[model samples]
Target: MSMSVPVVGNFRQVPEVAQAGCRITERPENDLTDYAQLLDVIDVGICAVDRTLCIRSWNAFMAAHSGYGSREVIGRPLFELFPELPQDWLKERFDRVFDLGVPSFTSWEQRRYLFSFPHNCPINGGVESMQQDTRLLPIKDELGRVVQVLVCLFDVTDAVLLHHRLAETIQVLEEERQEQQQLIARLAETQEQLIQSEKLAAIGQLAAGVAHEINNPVGFVMSNFRSLEHYVEGAFTLIELFDRHIDVLPAEARAQVARLKQDMDYEFVANDVRALVAESRDGLERVKRIVSDLRDFSRVGETDWQWANVHACLDSTLNVVMNEIKYKAKVVKAYGDLPEIECMPFQLNQVFLNLLVNAAQSIRERGTITLRTRTEDDHVCIEIEDTGAGMTPEVMKRIFDPFYTTKPVGKGTGLGLSVTQSIIGRHQGSISVASTPGLGTTFTLQLPQRHTTAM
Candidate 1:
């Protein structure tokens, strides 16, 4: 019988005695060495099975890998000789080679260990079993009829282990990348908070000084206005007495007095004088109220929690930002009567100022800004709505992000909403907004009446 052998072309240490695919006839015993010697010398594990799946030939490489001698495995059924073999899978592979006359291949990635061969290479010395890359080849007879199949397996444990290690390395690098991004975000937020805190501190100092400096002048002006009002009343009474005595005067004197009174428009002057003095008094009172509001809003040294009137906070903030808003929008206040709640009034006042100023700036020319306050369950809700150029969803998403702004070059600092959010967070409050482009924007602030923790 002729044995099937693979062509070992130019293999190191292979003898050049037989050409590949050359079948040997049942010649003299000395002629067998021409084909048999090459198959026994190659390192690639080789085994042949006939149509009945009986082990027909087992080379030296197969004997070394499987630990079975050629004499023991030859002539036995391949599935019976190796009980651990995937019998059905191997049979299907064999059928394709024997029945269809086509070869098949299986990579190490698909099936790691095929024969459970013990590790032999120094590079894979630590591995408990060998990994293999296998191939099945058809063996045809002289009549071109397929009679047997040759199975070849190559050790590939080192390559598979290297691939696994590289994959694990990539996973670790991805995790590190995500962690670095998170750290950078935290650092940026901290830096923004520091800058905002310094700005607020400076403003607090300035507000305190300005309020003190203006308070004295406002106090004296109000006092002097009251005295002026009294003087105007006395002057009007004397003028009335003089008119009553005019009829008793000599005819010549009476005529002269009438001409003087007519020329002076005395009645009109008297009425207008009273109105002017009243207006002056009202103006002085407004100045005094503004100074008082400034003092209340800049109460910076008083950091401890205290009961605060919410209505007063809203009113004071309105006055503080009146110049910015009055020219842009009509302000409407719907204040709800509520009890005082514990909070840092100055910080809350800052929040109100930021929201009111932002609402005003949103308007291109003129709009209406409505401030509404109402008590909900355990909290107070302050809503500031403006009929201005509203925000798109893209802009609204990053509205409170540090250094983000929609305003023109020099008009906005971009820190208003960010600082407002920080202060509200410390107060354990929340702010939310809803808007539609070209329609308007509404910002709602919810504050707990009494926070259990200190800010």
Candidate 2:
């Protein structure tokens, strides 16, 4: 006997499925019989429901999985037979198919299964139930009206499990890649820091040698200068006594001596000698002060923490880099009362040198670099501000990152600020920066007054 069977097709007449190029078709009675047999024998679950949600057809796959034979489920309300289904949501899907005469689909990703059938594979034991990919196709009558909706359930439990496993594997791989990148970055930073430390050590040694050599010559020169000043003063006094005794000489002799004195320009020489001596003394003193500043700044072999004056450290650092700054910017010292702070003096000097040199380099033309210092409770606050070409927000964000630089290739190694920050951290201190593009930039350092072992 021939029975009605739904034929799957591209429902092109339905507005929603038109773009999808789908339409339902009818078959002869003999062909319908063959189709029904094909549906019953197939592994997929096939069933049909009418407008009142009554089951009209049930296939072998549905009967086997649901444990309800065709005779028992047919003509029964679908919701009554399988009350575990999402009645409202599933009804809406069926209603749309019936009214539009189009097919609707739900993947296993969207919903695990339409019916609670345990998965058949014992190997994939992680899944508790069968995962299904479901579809609803409209069954049309001869007059082109939707009489019922055909539901097809595909067991996609394996595919769903594989997808979840793939996603988990990908997530694990991504996390590993991120960790490797972070490790590589940290290694690069550590290497750069080591190189910088070696360079600083070499520089300190060189500075110590130079300071020692200069001190010897300076010491003797200063001693000789004192002796020369004494002799010159004695000669000047003798000349004054000679001038007072000129009245006792013969008039012709006195006239002769006056003429000789005028020819020698003795009075001018006496006055000029004092002026020359004063200027020489001042120059020597300046040299001595510079040498002293250099020695203090280098502090080779002085790595242990010690009580140091912050202002003194800054001044010594400024003196060491004065040549670099003098040509590019004018320096202004706005000092305030500050107490001694325990720190690595040479390292602090390095920090100040880096900041001061950076401030000088930032100015393309002549500008002012102002050094300000003050006491803030238990900390000494120092600020190096420059009226130069300042940084953009983006540049400022990465300024302390190792090996990140905006300067010309050879002009910067990009480790200066990074090293400066490390030194501050070692001192149990903090450094912060503020900048405006056209106006200027300021780097403030706050160092604690006492050293802590945690640092």
Candidate 3:
């Protein structure tokens, strides 16, 4: 049986329906009031409950969707018809409206649906439940006393789901942007490393060629000088023998010999020739040492580990940079007894050379550059200290960063300390610096006695 009372009247008799001019049904014997007429035709879901929580009205929209006809649910308690409802909260909401006669509202964002009605859109295929926006209206009697509450629900499923998907899309794009930035940074670092390697290779080749060419000519000249020394000595001996024999010569011959000796300054030439020859030999020896140092520094294929004296490598490096530091700083070596360490000797020589040159350039005037070494347990320590104008704290912080320079633009390439650090790292060693602005700077290197065979 249909619990909805069909409206049958002169439609003009129900003023609310007459205002909208809704036509009446044919049966005039079953009469209907204006309120019931209006509830039957509205688009929103509408239901009215009395103070006792008994359903007083269930409209056509509510009846068709809830699977409960008006006859079955109208006289029952609201929760008895729908056991899934939150009984306590719904009762409180009803009590507030019945007691105070005020309205209330809730959105689908806060609670997805109140009734769990099926969303029968063909586009969605009814996979998801309907989303709702609900409102509660207080119904009052003539003296303004609340009698019943009307519940209205609006479907808002599409808008809420669209907003959720847009937020997720934004988050995904942001993560992809951050990953691209990191890849670009890595490529830039690799490019700089390749450029530096090519520059080092070219320098090594040039140094090796110069040393080889100079060595051949120097060897022949040294041999010729030695033969000339012997010849000059024999000539001096002949002159001395003549002085002894002068007493036996004729008077005229003696006068002529004495005159010739005085005119030629024979004694002075004899003494000076020996001195000049000795000085020339010493100069040649220095040239030989310089060539040896250059060859060691610029060797290309000495990458294997070997037992080498750290002190000897330091001495060779010092000789190589002697002219640069000799005028500006006096070098003082404070050597400590240390065992031979297994290392790449050529690479370590490069480290020492860089430190010595930096110490020399630090001094504004004449100062003492000290090289100190010590053995601590299984490791070796070397310190290069200069009594020169030292670095400030800011300069010390980034001293090893590639291409970061405190020197004037053209005077430095800024890779000296950075390359020194790389070689030390390869040897399983550490380097550190300490400085004060007015006093001086010291660089300390701590190296393991031996490294593993791994490169």
Candidate 4:
């Protein structure tokens, strides 16, 4: 009933077995040849062994690969020929096969135990290794006995190597993607700075001319006030003399003077003169402030950082650019209270200055420029909204590229937005512009209220 033929034989009789001698039970008298032929055709390495652990059906595929022949290996103890098949493992399962006869299986790939066959797996250049996918199954006999165990092995080096390569490739791609993202962020910030700088330069040129024009009117008014003050002082002195000498005049003359004084309301004149002088002084002060702001606005100097009163800078900038906005643009200020920021104040000044002017410029003759500010987290936000010509989406996309002027060739440096962005970058801030063709454009600046130390 045993599916495995016993390994008993006189090697001299069967030429195939005789060529190599074995030392176990006799081979099956019937079907011995058929078993030998079947071993050659199975795809994987296959071998059969009896309950005694003797090689029973040695296939050409298994025998040829293992350097063992039918007669020489068949009668040998399984451990003698292949120690990779441990004695405990071989006997334990083989005893089960001989006793209860239950079939069993194994999918141990390239795992080494104390077995002759496991060690027999060849390694070129003196380094040992094994096929990665191997399985073993038992063959049952008619009496419900596992008479033989069939072992199969497969090579799986390709799959394992491929997995490692794929993981490495993915890691490299992730690094590249992160680097690309950083590059884009830096590019955007740089473009913003360039555009802002250009805008400031343009406005600075314009402010210089306007400040001069305003200062002239202020000069004449100041001179007129001084002259008026001198003449008014003389008038006061004469009135005082009359007041002092009135008792000495005749009653008639004194009475006449009294009537004149009552008609003139001398007390009112004295009180009103002081008020007029105060008002005039205040007016002159306003003129002086305007002149001073204009000077600050026209700060065409080296680019560097400074602690600046952002509000003051913006006020002066607005005043100097007033000529550009006075008649056509309705200006609104929604400013917030904030501590002065540490920055390239001149450059930042130029940035906002340009933004305000640009907002005003965006509008056609007679529009609006709304300037608003708020504290945005740790930074300040300045929003400049304009009722201007606006722009199409396509134009907006390339607006920050150098030489991308929307204004006429002679008019714009095309770097206004780019420069603004760069200034923001140096301060670790951000700027964004949004617009609708017919509606208007809004430029927003989110600036860090304080300077940051480099890590």
Candidate 5:
């Protein structure tokens, strides 16, 4: 005989089970009993509740975890058997499933567990109870009217635990990546500083050598010029005395002397000789001053910190770079009374040179570079202002970054401002720039009157 059996979400007819040790070719009449036996051995937690919330069916997985046999839970109200379950919430879910004849799902992420079963696995020690993902499946009869709701529970404790571990691992890796980026930035700054120091040292040596070579010839030239001036004065005095006594000479002799004087342009020659001597002397003095300025600006072997006149430093550096600026822009120095400050003079000179050259180069045509210096409290403030092709906001933001420049390639190394900033920092000072596109730029420097340990 064939019989009907209710299994999970569907109803089916099947042949009944045969008696043990007997082979029967025809169908038996106990199919529902066979279906019930099949449901008991399944691994998942399977249960069905009716419209009144009474348990209609329970499987072995449910009995094993809840410690309640099928006979104990079957026919009992589901809430009565497990008082820990959220009664109103679960009832609402069941009502929705029954009314809609549809399925609903809940995962471990939203709601951890439904049944409150103890964790069965030994390795997931971090979790105290089993995590579950549940499905509410509606069951209907022949007319397609919803009768009961089947609840299927899946054990997802391991997946949830693994997810937590993976999140922690990712957090640690992200922190490490940020640390490495910071380290790389510091290393690049150190490398740029080293390169700038080497270049400054080489330039200082060359300046010192040139100054020494020029000083000797300039000294002797000035001395000989002074003696030549005296000799010319005596000769002109004797010529004046002879002119006063010219009436004492014979007629022929006097005529010969007159012809010689006219031919030689004697008065013009004497006057031009004195003027030429004055001009040559002035030129030599300028050469001598340039050599002296070069020596002061470089201070090659004077790397040790010492008390230096700030005005003197600026003047020497300005002279050293005069050729670069004289044609491009007019420099106006507004000096203020400032006390000597302790510093590495050569390094400070480099800073001045860099800023001045940059100010001059910024001007496309003739412009003004005004240098103003003054003492304010314990600091010396210097401003190098230029009426030049100023920078945009974007360019100003990155002007101090190493190898960042707007100058044409091959004309600039882009490290000038970067190295300039570094030098100022080494003296425990600060440098800042203010620029307006198409207007001009001003670089302001503040140096402490007293030296302190550099950062």
Candidate 6:
């Protein structure tokens, strides 16, 4: 018969062995050690099937893992013991592996085929009750004809579960990092907006002071012009009478009356008449220019972009704040030749206004504020320097934070430098400051020469 004795010498110790292939070798001595004892052993299940898919070899590990004994599984169609598996499909692959001398496998797909637990295998029962990795390996006969199929199994549920858990944790951390970045960006923008609002508030307060200051000087100058107009009418009347009476007078009297008069008392009445007209006209013109500049500088959020003259904006802001600096500080300007830069004119005007005011305020008294500008290859450089009480490192570090004030509660909101930095950065430019506590401070702003976006 083709059936043969087990290869292991101590055969009785093993639960079962599958005779999947034709055994062709001559029998060895009974005293020789056999295959089962020579190999490591486990309690997990194993099985073998013939060409018709009937169970052949059933090992102790298979019996223990499957909770099925050899007696119940052997000689039975393998599918009858585990109906949960795709029986016909598994059978086809198994058949093909043997036919093609290839191997086949299955797992996870069928959790419970015979029993729920390996420990549940019947005593003489096999270990086929646990989670499994079943395979079909081809066996060849001496003539190379296919003979049987071998199947093996393992318990991998724990490993599969751990892999899934690790994947989930990684996903959670990445999501958190992204959220934090977005939050940081949002917080920075909000802080910048708040700083700008405070600066605008300070400007409003300064504007009130400016209005009060200008009104007094303006009222008198305007009155002076009005008075001078009436005086001109009187002077003209006197001249007409002199002209009419001139012909009757001799040549000597006419020459004296007609001679050109100097304002420094060459001819008193004529000089007084000329001086009043000239001074009043000049005063009115000066007042008109100052008012126009104030309006330009204070105009709010101009969204439209234009080729704007930054120099003109600076001139306007400086004029508006002239009264503030005039008494305490002297402004020294080193304006350079420049091209018209494109931007939101009114917004840039606000920037200039902030910078100039800061420069003026930096000085305690009787100091100099230097305003300078230059153009490099692709950028415009503006430097504002003041000889005033400069900053310490501690103050500079906290200067950009909102509401961090160094000035006493009313005089400063401490938002000016922060706002200046934000505006410059928004324009794709950079701003930096250098200071020495007792010497002075310099704020340098660098802007791109050409902007792609319309400000």
Best by TM-score: 3
- Global local distance difference test of model 5: 0.82
lDDT of each residue in 256-316, candidate 5, tens digit only: 9999989999879989998998899899988998999888766743657889998888988
User: lDDT for every model?
Assistant: 0.81, 0.84, 0.80, 0.68, 0.82, 0.68
lDDT of 3: 0.80
Candidate 5: clashing pairs of residues: 1-27
Return whichever of 1 and 5 wins on lDDT: 5
* Model 1 lDDT per residue over 298-405, tens place: 774456677898888888889988989999999998888677887888888888999999999999899999999999999999999999999999999999987788
Please say which candidate is ahead in TM-score: 1 or 3: 3
TM-score of each: 0.61, 0.62, 0.63, 0.44, 0.62, 0.48
* Candidate number with the higher TM-score (1 or 2): 2
Off by over 4 Å in 2: 1-160, 232-278, 452-454
Point to the candidate with the largest lDDT.
Answer: 2
Per-residue lDDT tens digits of candidate 4, residues 350-428? 6877787777777777888888888867888888899988899999899876657778878887766766776678789
Per-candidate RMSD, Å: 8.5, 8.9, 10.7, 16.7, 8.3, 19.5
Runs of candidate 3 exceeding 4 Å displacement: 1-186
Model 1 / residue 98 / CA error / Å: 39
Q: Give the TM-score of candidate 2.
A: 0.62
Q: Which stretches in model 1 have alpha-carbon errors above 4 Å?
A: 1-189, 250-265, 300-302
Model 4 residue 18 distance off true place after TM-score fit, in angstroms: 73
Candidate 2, residues 111-183, lDDT tens digits: the string is 8788999777744548879899999988766576777788989998887788889989999999999999999
The parts of candidate 5 lying over 4 Å away from their true place are: 1-160, 228-276, 300-303, 418-430, 451-455
Q: Compute the lDDT of residue 18 as modeled in candidate 2.
A: 20
